[model samples]
Target: MTEAPPDRRRAGISILSKLLAMLLGVSLLSALVAGIVGYRNGTDSLRAAAIERMIEVRESRAREIEAYMDSLRHTIILDSRGIAAQAIPELHDAFRELDEEPVPASEQAAVRDYYEQTFVPELEGRQGGEADVGALLPTSDAAWHLQASYTAADPDWDVRLATNDAGDGSAWSAANAKYHDFFRETVEQKGYEDILLLDDEGNVVYSAYKGVDLGTNVLTGPHSGGALQDVFEQAERATSVDTMAISDLERYTPSEGRPTLFAASPVGSGGQASGVLVYQVPMDEIDGIMTSGGAWEKTGLGRTGETYLVGPDHLMRSVSRGLLEDPEEYRDQVVANGTPRETADRQVAVTGSVLLQPVESFAVDESLRGRSGTGVSTDYRGHETLGAWMPLDIPGLQWVLVAELDTSEAFEPVRDFTRNLLISVAVLVLLVSLASLLLAQVFVRPVRHLVSGVREVAAGNLDARVAATSRDEFGELAGAFNEMARSLRTKADLLDEQQGEYERLLHTLMPEAVARRYQDGEETIAESHSDVTVVYAEIVGLDDLTRDMSSDEELETVNLLVRGFDEAAERLGVEKVRTLRSGYLASCGLVVPRVDSARRSVEFVREMQRVVAAFDAQHDAALRLRAGLDTGTVTSGLVGRQNVVYDLWGDAVNLAFSLPRANDRPGVFVSAAVHDRLRDQYSFREAGTVESGTGGSSTGPEPVWELEEDSRG
Candidate 1:
């Protein structure tokens, strides 16, 4: 037992451990798989959201870019042929001479002197507010698109030629000062880089952000190869002054070679073409729109997301996100795109800051060809990136908007989600494992207790009882086990009592030896005995007394008298064989022969007479009792099925009953066979022999005798 407990506990623990392990293993595996799948799904969802955000940013920038261009075009037309389009005669003559290509050096020197002495002073002398300058303002009917060449073909290109050198009070000076503020304030409020008015011959008549551009003919100047030729040619062919034309994106040396677009519209007065209004709209304004919406923040693109426009030539038209926030990364990105590192640094310095240098990527290439879609690909910086691209809907501008970001930055939220998911799954699995182990221990306790109790019962210890620890199946099992043990004990007691009763009944029914023979499975019960005494005793008036008595009283009186006889017979060493209707039949030495069998029968008969006489006296009634005895060869046997009787048979039993006569009194009457056997042991009165009559089964008459106890004894 010392070793058994440890071994059994180990076995129990091992079983519980295995069960817990299986359950937890399956649960954790399922949870892990589900978590991984959920993580992947969540990641994909974030990616989709990022791409959708990129598309929105791209669309928003496109709209703002279009709006910015429209504002510049509108401002250009309002000012042209109006405030800054005055073609003074002296100004026209001066511009005409200066517009000559490859003129004499002296002629160019004279034109420069004229601009320093006349144009510079008159242009700076404008003063005060001019609220009623409407008369000076040209009507919309003024024709600006009728001129043919890069010459002073219309007066609107003429700048007011300075003459008197009187300073700040002249009409030209007043108008110069008044509209100077107009151009400057337009640039401030409307975000145009420059607003220029050109003559019909494409001469720069007036300039905002005034530089060398004023008083020069753009067709023959350093910027001649730019959109000036196209604008003049288109204006020459226009049928109305409202005719507008736009040039493709390009760099103009007049604007320091930054990317620019020229939108030119003709100014008109009374349907006569007078001048062309050109809005020197810089691409930088579009760049500002591209960066307006905080796309990275709204779209969850975080650090590296950008929205930019690209021309049909596949060059970026807008700035990059990294250029603004992370110039170092932007430098590396542009250097990788064929820019010399020193050149990138020089260019960034020359621009007074870094810029998203132009570089074509997969998205740019696709958008340039009018294709539109979204995907993951290497970006302009050669990093794996996600992007969405679509063409802009503005007319005459084959431009596209693209939104892009590095994949790592775009899917940043997904990464964080996955990390948290991993931590949560690990913790949950741990908790489940621990919980399973504890539950296993709790569950196994009841089973172990039950096993121990069953083992005790197997070892025959019925007292070994299991404690019902909980209201569960184990408790029910313990209760059932206790009931089984009790039932076994009760059955054992019942078996012992039943066995005792069986033996007693068997003994009461027959002699011990005969009963033993029956218990041994003997089918027939019979025995032959020589000189066995058979006696029949009767209550003399039992039938007559029963007629006068109630049923229960008659039965009780008979029972009392019969029981007294049986007691006396038992005391005299005789067996009471059968009793019927107050008649008692007894045998002496029927099972085993005895020399005193007849004498014992005579004593039993004397006892029966005394018992009957005493019963009559005790009850205060005269009840006759008689006995007849015969001593002869008799056969004894058991009869009946449900209840059996042991009695003497053959001649001896018949002669005993025949010995009684109708005239006989209440005394023992015996056949001569009994007198012959018991006359010496006790005295008897000899009676005359009687012939066999209807009352007897005997073949011949037998002498009878009256029985008495021996007085000498």
Candidate 2:
């Protein structure tokens, strides 16, 4: 006769199997969650870091450009001061000494002779010796003769005429007659290119050269419409000592391109405006400071990044990089009809503060207000750029000193870092995941074998044994399993009796269907029908009850309550699932059939009330049991591996939980879904809807009906 299968076999479970299952499940879940969270956090951190870095770059550029503008202002101021010192003394003396004196015909003839022979020879010889011979000569010799004739006509001609004959008889002229000669000679001899003496009303009194006419209003000169003339007028109106001014004259020269910096200082006599000592420096010269000392090439500053000058009227007066070769072209491309290239100009104007890499271009018209410095980044001339703008304090010109660095160049390092960081992160994730998977397989292989062996043993195969491969924990576990299997084989004859005891234990611990599911290694999903109902019972104030008790005592009381509820549910042919402390989740007509889910729910409630009353009668401490019931189709399944539990899900389960909280009367509260299913068989009080927490929607008021114990059939 074939030997009967072993009944118990110690349930054939090794500690290693439990430990491995727990570890794998927990590790996989933890790693997956951690990876997702880490990726999100890493991306957020990178984006924030990028923005902060860009802001810093913008701030640095703003400070740099501001310093550059200050340097340019100082250069212009120093030049003005130098020119004023040289011209002011002579101009004041000439104006102050003007007088009318009488002269005889003989003295006049002598003065005239002295001027032509001594003074004229000296002036001609001086002009010839000068490096710029053409600078001293007018286009027409007639202009020179007219000046000489004017000198000869003066009345006090002989008194101030300097003679080479040492007071001997020579032609002479008044001091006023020599003034024009002195003015022309001084201006040319001093290397004052393009000199013009202006009267108080801003009219050109005389010109060293004839191409530009004298007796013309300086304000209406060809090169006088722009900022240059404005600076001159401002200085003429000033009452201060030797006032100075600087401005940018746009379109000054049509061919040489771009604007020029017009720096001038007042030449005054005893508080009366005499003339302006003006100097014109091409705008490129001031902007050259950025490229000076070979910083641009040496510092890896790209050609796309350049420094430029912008007028207050939103016009690019001068630019470097030769990208936009002409000032007009640059202005046309960026500022069309006096509008800014980007919207950031509005912000810069409003804030009057620096915006670092604002991702937009700014307008000089708006951003040049009130001595503020700022930076912005935007598409300039169709190319991405990082630009900084600071107000240029040229005395009479409203302009901004602007510097731009191409974004691709400025953030190259950041781009490389981001690329490398992403590459590194990808590599790390790949390596980690690969290593983890390999390690898991290596670790789980032995455990799987041991589990399979134990399961075979539990299935009545006493011959099942584990292979002892290595000397680690797994090897030891395998050896222990083998030993236990051998011992089980020796007791094979007494297995029939042990099988009865094992069945009794299983039935005591769990319902028949659940025990069968565990035995068969089959997952069970408990389905609910119209005739099925779910009940959720919870013990109130359980947390407070356990606070004062020892851990073991707390556990014992919790287990007792859970066990009692489980027993009651099982007796009524309901599947009970244990939850957190003081709560038992169970469903009727899930495993067993019922006529009406509401009636079944009522019966379940009545039974629970009877059990609670009996227990209260026996014990001094009355245990308050609150039960909630709801009838609907619910999905129930076994969840977890080691500590497996049969759980119910869906809106039905949520409503069931809400019902108990809605109940004020001590017994059971049934949801509308439940009440409608069995309203004829069971009577209930209309409690209406009570706000309760469920369904992931905040605590909501749900319709609940109260069922008293007496109302149950």
Best prediction by TM-score: 1
- RMSD, candidate 2, Å: 28.2
Off by over 4 Å in 2: 1-217, 220-226, 253-258, 290-304, 320-377, 386-395, 401-422, 445-713
Tens-place lDDT per residue, model 2, 1-713, is: 89978776576655555655566566666656765676566665754554454444434544554565555446434533444444444433432332112334454454346445544454444322222223322222222332233333332323212221122121222322334454455444433333444545554443333222233344764334565567678777777534557665543321122234555666654565556655444444343444443355443445455655555454455434433234445444445433354432322322211111121345344456654443445544555665555665444566565556666765565566566656765666666656655665566464776778978998989998778998989889889989988987877757768888977976654567777777777755354444468888776656665678899988987776666666666666776655667777777777676755456556766776666666567644466678888877777666677776656687777878777766554567888777777677777887778664454566567788887556746
Q: List lDDT for all candidates, in order.
A: 0.66, 0.54
Write one digit per residue (lDDT tens) for candidate 1, span 144-225: 1101111112122223221111142334333445455666666667666666667666666555554445555666653466
Best by lDDT: 1
Candidate 2 weakest ten by summed lDDT: 350-359
Model 1, C-alpha of 27: deviation from truth (Å):
0.6
Model 1 CA deviation exceeding 4 Å by range: 1-14, 78-181, 293-301, 352-356, 447-713
Kindly give the number of clashing pairs for every candidate. 21, 14
Evaluated at residue 76, the lDDT of candidate 1 is 62
- Residue 629's lDDT within candidate 1 is 78
